[model samples]
Target: MLMIFGTWASQVMSRTLHEASIAEKYEQWMAQYGRTYEDNAEKERRFMIFKDNLEFIENFNNAGNQSHKLGINKFADLTMEEFKATHTGYKSTQPKSSKTVSPFRYNDTEDVPSSLNWIDEGAVTDVKDQRQCGKGITILSFVSSYY
Candidate 1:
């Protein structure tokens, strides 16, 4: 009985160490290539969920005959109910217009520029880190309007 308990304890410790190693690797990868979130309880909770999802995705892909390069670029930390409440309450009240406009016509196709580099023209704004605030759409709209 004592030997059996010792074996079980060793197995548990090995599993715990393996999990810690994976978590450490994930942290290093995040620091190198991913966006950093604030170090808080909420962020920690989201990180754990994200890690579990990533592992599940990796296992599923490996189990299949065909290799699918699946990955998680961002984590949706909010619960489904919370997400629905935040995003579904607002309804647009604007009435639709019945007016039609003629399509734009250009006379000289040769005069049209083939490509544009907004960054080279100094029209693009620097990337902003709006961590956990969810103001990406607003920022993008403001930047696009500048052009």
Candidate 2:
């Protein structure tokens, strides 16, 4: 019947429009991050990850109570495991030594402040952002704190 055909056509049209919108969004995200893929398969895989990350970001931002918000960055296309494995720096290949347990030394629990702020007391350094590679901010901060 004509009515059935119209309903099916409208559904198909809506799906097509949705797909187009998603593709456009992904394209814009890729452009913003200067991303590219070697092939369609890889692109599709990364696109799915990007979509999931976007959804997470949106949900976090939509929450009523939050101190900060998240945005799409250069690492948006990576899965959580893949991101941790790649960005977590070097891994040791050495064999493990025998474990040893030590008894507790500090027995006094009184006269201690509820909170500590080493940064405000000039005992520790402040937090810094490392957007790029090979700047050596962490160890340098520790050394400067002592020096």
Candidate 3:
């Protein structure tokens, strides 16, 4: 009867240790998963806000002069400050203009790579009279040439 009691006691002790090891492992995994989830959520939020601000800037840039007269600079400065505060790791990834050309030459030079064969420069049959030249023409040329 003493031997039987010892055997039962040993089994119960082993089972308790086994359960504790499993619980510890489970807790460790949960902590790791929680950190990963939080990191991903933070990245997603930053990207979303960045995208929204970029779209607003693009639309504002495309607007006419009268629309441009609005207090966009003040708003943009405030928004940028807020964005930088929230997303501390954020940095502008935009590359500087590689073309060593002035605005006058940039629009005039047409010798783009042949690999971009999809750009149909002559296909633009119609544009408003005011857009026939200047910045719109430059933008159109760039878009058409890159295609």
TM-score of each: 0.44, 0.53, 0.24
Measured by TM-score, the strongest candidate is 2
Runs with alpha carbons beyond 4 Å of true place in candidate 1: 72-147
Evaluate residue 37 in candidate 3 and report its C-alpha lDDT on the 0 to 100 scale.
28
lDDT at 126, model 1: 63
lDDT of each: 0.64, 0.80, 0.52
- Candidate 3 residue spans exceeding 4 A from truth: 35-147
- Cand. 2 Cα-lDDT: 0.80
Candidate 2 TM-score over all chains jointly: 0.53
lDDT of 1 by residue, 1-147 (tens): 999999999999999998888677667656666646677776687667666767776787888876566665444344445455566454445664778866656544565455665655688756677565454445442323221
The TM-score, computed over Cα atoms with residue i paired to residue i, of candidate 3 is: 0.24
Ranking by lDDT: 2, 1, 3
Please provide, for model 3 over 59-133, each residue's C-alpha lDDT reduced to its tens digit, 9 standing for 90 to 100: 766676544532222122235757555544466667767887556656656776744433454645444465423
True lDDT of residue 112, candidate 1: 49
RMSD, model 3, all Cα superposed? Answer: 21.3
- Per-residue lDDT tens digits for candidate 2, residues 1-147, read 999999999999999998788788899989998899999999999999988988899899999599999988888899987776687664556665878766766655676666666777788777666665534545334322211
lDDT of 3: 0.52
